[model samples]
Target: MKFCLALLSLFFAVVVADHGDHSDYVVKTGEDLARYRDQCVAKLSIPADLVEKYKKWEYPDDEKSRCYLKCVLESFGLFDDAKGFDVHKVHHQLGGGDVDHSNELHGKIENCAKEGDAAGEDACTRAYRGALCFFKENLALVKQNVASK
Candidate 1:
């Protein structure tokens, strides 16, 4: 119950904090998203390659859905610790515990992947995908969590 309440509060906070409410910026279709890609590059001066990242920032194409979800979330934002208020940590803190519990046995594999020591970073990366999946599968839950608080 407490966990649920905490989650509710979190969702509302995110909603409130994101005042830009860039609802108008949504990429509803392949072509629509393509335009946004152009806008993002022209407006923000972000590189074309960087914009391409948005497309790749998605759930896995041929792997575990959960794994893909983690990958997507990881790419949502450009996390630079040098910049203040690292939102990346918030996402990580929120979703990692569940992944940790569900896939604990394979924990070392993930940990190694994170540090570039894992046999294959290509195969084991999950933080981003996990977050993306979490948001997609639980958008309502997140909104509720933020609102409650």
Candidate 2:
């Protein structure tokens, strides 16, 4: 009986440990981004059809997709209510103090934001557009960074 109880306690501990908090969702590398993409879709309750479209690089331009992007960005600490796209946080989180790479990426994102009317849209909409732009334009650099790791 004592052995069974000990085994049950260990199982419960392992289960609790595996259930990581929100920070676990943050994507810091290419592999992490890939994993979190599916997790974010499920967590945000994005529809299956939309997920399929997004996987095919087709922007649905819909609210559910927008919300999923927002949730993913928020998990990465890239988006905030008071300061949209917290560049410093993103730099620290994704670049690991590589100021030069961070600056370059930041400039690219800034340029992308400039060509848009994100201010007129809701938070989710803006995040979706920004994330799409970033991924489309800067995925190479991000993947390179992951490779270097």
Best by TM-score: 2
lDDT of 1 by residue, 55-120 (tens): 554333433433333332223332221231223233333333222323443343334224432233
Positional deviation of residue 131's Cα in model 2 after best superposition, in angstroms: 1.7
Candidate 2 collision pairs: none
- Estimated TM-score for each candidate: 0.23, 0.61
lDDT of each: 0.39, 0.66
Candidate 2 local lDDT, residue 140: 66
lDDT of 2 by residue, 1-149 (tens): 99999999999888777443222434377566567778888887877888888665566778888887777677666786445675545544545543453367667766555433356677877777776776688766655654555
- In model 1, state the lDDT of residue 129: 36
TM-score of 1: 0.23
For all the candidates, what are their Cα RMSDs to the real structure?
A: 13.6, 12.5
Lowest summed lDDT window (length 10), candidate 1: 77-86
